[model samples]
Target: MPEYQIFKNIQKHISLSDSERQLFISLVVEKDIAKKEIVLEQGSISRKLYFVEFGSLRAFNVNEEGRESTIMFAVQDWWITDMNSFINQKPALLSIETLEVSRLIEFDFSTLEELYKRLPKFERFFRIIFQNAYIREQLRVLDKISFTTEQQYTRFVEKYPQIVQKVTQKQIASYLGVTPEFLSAVKKK
Candidate 1:
């Protein structure tokens, strides 16, 4: 097995011995996802968490009017899942779809539970991951309420320059809570 990216990501949070690494790797399944594929649909149960090895994905929710609100995006070396659904084994509130042909490492819910029991360090690693995600989301909320649209766009670009390159302007506009036309005008100014 080509074993570097996922191990590298885990090493940042917790140290794992060769045996532990092997065990964890054994439990994961690698997937090649097609562009625009819906990996998890809203209202369906989410059974797996994905780590992007290469390419990008977006998670979004649709309202009664069928308008999408982008919740988040995941790219190389990042993790993506409908956390509420994954944790509770309930129906997902967000749908996850690929933005490009992507390679991902997936961990099934039961496998993760077993891994946690066998390798306790993973619990800490996942906790840290979720904590950082929470912090980022909280800051994003504050930025939305406190900053102007232009300022928000600037900050988004500054923070996720890589994402800006990979995704469309319309997707970015959705993330920033603006219309694509507004985003274009902001870019023009």
Candidate 2:
């Protein structure tokens, strides 16, 4: 396998020997998804976690009124998946779709299980990843409940300028819990 962002991502978190690294790389599979492709749809089981090598993706859900609420966006070097579905092998409530033609590396759950069993350090690697994910979710929840709209938008723009630039104005508004008009007014000031 050629060198990819996934290798750098894992190395940043955990040190792996040459053999272990090869094994890990062997388990990964790559795919190219076109824009508007739905990788994981609502009610489908999410069997793999995807690492974005290039381009962007968004996770979202539609409510009874048929409004789409953006949950999260993953760009280059970021990992995205439906956590509950991937972990429990249950149906996902969110849909993960590509926003642009993208290259992603998928980590299969069963293969990861084997990695954890065969290499203990990988367990630490996943633990750190999951822990950070949980913490980020918690902090995002707090931010939504406490921060003003402008504050949230400012932080969102600062943290994910690439996402903001790639997604449509309406999508960004939905993600920020604001109306498109409001977002436009905010942008003006």
Candidate 3:
């Protein structure tokens, strides 16, 4: 199985026994997603967490004006989901879509619950994953409040050079809370 990528991601914080690894592999479903495919739409209940095996995805929200505000980008080895909705089984605040043709490992919430029961170690792994995700988002918020637009752009580039190559300036601008025109100017400087 081409599931080694997911195993590698899991191994970052937790070690799994051979049988536990096999069980995890059995629970996840691998999917081939096309470019621009919306995996989770706003207002729908979020049920799955997607791990990018390859390619890229973005989570963003559209306002009443239909303007998109990017929340985050996920490249290979990264996980993306509408965390609030997924955790609570509520309507999603963000929509997740692929930026490129992608392969992903999908874990349904029920399956995760099962995994947690069968292997308590998975709970620790996910706890750490959520903590790291929270920290990254907290830092992003701090950056927005503390840095200039150019500095924000620079930090974003330094942090996600792989994503910068995969997505458009408009998308990057949305993530940075700026207009595409403004991003163009930032790039010029």
**What lDDT tens digits, residue by residue, belong to model 1 across residues 118-178?**
9988899999999999999999999999999999999999999989999999999999888
User: Distance (Å) between predicted and true CA of 50, model 3?
Assistant: 0.8
Q: 1-189 in candidate 2: lDDT tens per residue?
A: 477888788888898778887888777788999999999998899998999999999999888898888989999988899999999999998999999999999988988888898888889988988898889889889989999888888898998898888999888888887889998898888
The C-alpha stretches of model 3 lying farther than 4 A from their native spots are 1-3
User: In order, what lDDT does every prediction score?
Assistant: 0.92, 0.89, 0.92
lDDT of 3 at 176: 92
Report the lDDT tens digits of candidate 3 across residue range 44-155: 9999999999989999999999999999999999999999999899999999999999999999999999999999999999999999999999999999999999999998
Residue ranges of candidate 2 with Cα displaced over 4 Å = none
Tell me the deviation in Å of residue 71 in model 2: 0.5
The 10-residue segment of model 1 with minimum total lDDT is 1-10
How close is every model to the real structure, measured as TM-score? 0.97, 0.94, 0.97
Clashing pairs in 1: none
In model 2, state the lDDT of residue 23: 84
What is the RMSD of candidate 3? 1.0
Model 2, C-alpha of 9: deviation from truth (Å): 0.6
164 Cα displacement, candidate 2 (Å) = 1.9
